[model samples]
Target: MKFKFSIIFSFFLYITYGQINVKGKVVSKSNQPLEGAAVFFNSTTIATITDENGEYQLTVPEGKYKLVASYLGFKTVEREVDINENTSLDRLNFTLEEEDSLLNEVVIGAKKKTKSKKPKYEDFLVFKEAFLGRTNYAEKCKIDNQKALKYYFDPATNTFSVEAKEPIIIINRDLGYKITYNLEKFQIKDRIISYFGYSQYEELEGSKRKKKKWKKNRKKAYHGSLRHFLKTFITANTKEEGFDINIMHRVRNEKHPSDSELAFSKKIFEFQDKRSVPINFNKVIVKPESKLDSAILIHQRQLKHPKIIDKLIKRNVSYSDISYRVEGKVYLKFDGFLKVTYNNEPEEFNYKRDIKRRLGVQKSNFLLFDSPQEILPIGQIADQNNRLVEGYWSYELFANALPLNYKPPKE
Candidate 1:
C-alpha cells in the first residue's frame, strides 16, 4: 500500500490531442431513423442526443474511442473508432435492436423466493460511493441514469449484489471521460466489495484551460497507479520506479486453518472424500469464503496483511521475475508475496495533492491488477481472495486509466 508517486508522477507530455469531428446516426433494425437516441463516445463527457432525423455529431480530442448509441428500451450499440489528425470522413452509424426487457435481475435461490425489500435511496447512494469510488476526484463522476441499475440484497448470506441490462453511462466531469460499463457482476460481502465487468472510455470535450488542468490532474492520478506499477514491474525497474519489493516463500504453519476456515476446509475436504491433496482453486485461493473455494487451509493467518506481519519466514524459492515475452505480453512467475514499499520519500512537488487523507493502512502482497490468471497464488500475493483490499491503489481509479496503446516517453 505504501507506494511512491515521484517516479510515476511526471506529466505524460507525449499524449496527443486535437479537436476531431465524428458524425453519426442511430436507426432501427428496419432502417428507420431512431430519434432522441443517446449517442456519445465512451469514457468521455462529450455526448449528444440524436435529432429528429437520427443524426448527431460529437467533437472531441483525437484518440481511440468507443462510440455508443443507446435509446430507452433498445439494445445499446458500441463501435470503436480511431480519430486522428489525418482521419477524415469518420462516420459512426448504428442500428439498434429493441430490448426484450429492461428487467435484468439475478435470483440465487433454488426456488423462486420472495423478493427482498426495495433498496432505499440511501442504499443507492452508498452503492454509488463504493462503486464509482470514494476518491476525492471520484466525486466528479455521475451516473446519467440511476434507475437503470438493479440491486438485490440477501439476508441469509448478508450479501448485496447489483445488475443492469444496459451499459451504465458514467460521466467523469473531473477527468472529462465517459465510461460505458456493461456490468456483469457486483457483490458486497464480508466487508469486502468485488465486481467485474467490461468497459470502454471516450474523451470528453473541454476548454483549453480545463484541458490543461485535466492534464495536470491526470498525471497525479496516474502516479503510483496499478497500470504504472505493472509497466515498471514488467521492465524490472522496481528500484528505479521507486518500489522496493521483498519476496518471501510460503511456510505453512504446522497448524491448520482456524475454527471457521477449518470448518469450510472440512466442507471442501469431505467433498473431496477426505483426501489430503492440494486443491487448485483459481490456482491460489486465499479466502475460504471465496466463490471458488476448493481446498483446505494450511494456516489461518497466511493471508494477513504484509505491513502488519514481521519476521516472515523468507522462502528461498527461485523463479523468473515479472517480465514480458517476445510478443510483449507481460508474464508473471513467482512463488510468494512480493512485499513492496515506496522507498522514495514524498517530494513537495504538489503539496496540495500529496496531503494524506484516510487512505487506509499500507498492506502488502496485494495484486496490482487482474491478469489472464483469474486466480493468483495466495502464497504469491497477500489478500489473493476475500474482498481484495487495495491500499493507496484505490485512489488511482479508472479516471486515471490509459489505453494499451500508450507508451511512456523515454526518460
Candidate 2:
C-alpha cells in the first residue's frame, strides 16, 4: 500500500457569542468600487460577496485571521488582521489590481494542443484515492467536475502530476456538504503523494431527520480528529478529553542498506545469474529463475522493514511540554514526534485489521517541522508548513473535512 500525505490549507472561521463586526470595501486601482467582489476570512465558511456598492460586512469571533478580497479579473489580496473588541472594523478596506490579460493570453497560447491528453480511468482512480481518500466517507463522496482536471506523467522521474483548470466541485452525501476546491497543486513523486488547495464549503439542504444524521456524523468526524486534539491541547484538557499524548523518538535504521550497496548487490546478482529478472531495484528484489534465488528471497525479507524506527516511546507528554504562551498567543514548540491516542473512541475495525494491532484506541502521530509555531485560538495552526501529521489524521481526506466554522452540537 502507498503511504499518502496531504498538505491542504484553506480559509476557515468559527463564530461565537462574543462577535466582532468587520466591514470592508473593495476597490480597483483607480479607487472605483469593484462590485460583486468576494470578501471573507481565509479558511472559514464565513464569506460574502460585495453588494452593488462593493461593501461587505462580517461578524466573527475575536481572533487572528487572514482577510481576503477576490474579484474576477482582479488579483486576489490577503491581509493579516488581529481582531479584538477594540479593533476598528471600519478601517478594514481593500484595493485589488486587475490581472494582466495580455500575459494570461500569452501563457495560455504557449501550451501545445498536442500535449493535452484526456485523463484516463486509471489516472482518475489514482487521483481519487489521493484526493478523496480511501475512507468510508470518501466512498460516499463524488467529484462533480472531472473535466476540469489535467494529468501529466514523467517517465524519467516516475512522477505523476495534476492541475485543475477550474475549481473542483464535490458533493459529499455522508457529510452533507458541497465543496468547491481550488486545487493549487498536486503531485506524486517517488511513491510519496502531496497536494495543496483552498476550499469553500456549503451545507447541503436536507430533511430534519437527515440533518440530525448529519449532525451526528459531523460530531463523529470531529472527535479524535486533528482539530479536536489541537483544541484539547490548547485548553489543557487532554486528560479530561481522553487524549493520551506521549513522546515518540524515531531514528534512521542502521541495518537498512544504502543506495550504493543495493546497486552493487544488484549488479553482482545479475552477473551470477543471467536469467534473473529484476523486479524492483529499490527493494532489491528479483524474480527467482533458479534455486540459488532462494538466498535473494531471504535478503528481500530482511529489507522489507521500514528505513525508520518506530514505537520508541520516550515518555508521557503534557500540554505545557509541547506548547507555550507568548504575549497571550499560544505557540507550539516541541521536539520529536507526539504519539496521541484518543481513548474515547476505538480504532476502526478495518484499520485495526490492516495494522494487525489489538489496541482499541485511535492513535495518530505528529511532528513539528518548526518550533514555536503559532496556533490560533480556533485550533488552527498559524503556519501550516510547520507541522506534519501521520496515521489516522492523515488518512481522513477531503471527504471527512469539516468547515472551520463548524461547531459541535450541544449534547
User: Which candidate comes out best when scored by lDDT?
Assistant: 2
Q: Which stretches of candidate 1 lie over 4 Å from their true place?
A: 1-70, 76-97, 102-106, 109-119, 164-173, 178-184, 190-192, 197-209, 233-236, 248-320, 343-364, 368-389, 394-411
lDDT of 1 by residue, 1-411 (tens): 232211111111112467778787789989899998888654334678899999998887675555677776787677766677776634578999986663533347763223337656766785685576556577788889777777777777887777776778888777666777666566676666666544556777889998887666666555555555545644556567666555654454534345566566657656666556555533555555752253323322344322233334343222235433545334554444455555443422222243445322232344333432221111112122322323454434444455333344444
Evaluate residue 287 in candidate 2 and report its C-alpha lDDT on the 0 to 100 scale: 78
Assess candidate 2 and give its TM-score to the true structure.
0.81
lDDT of 1 at 384: 29
RMSD of each: 11.7, 4.8
Worst 10 residues of 1 by lDDT: 5-14
lDDT for each of the candidates? Answer: 0.55, 0.74
Model 1: lDDT to the true structure: 0.55
TM-score of each: 0.56, 0.81
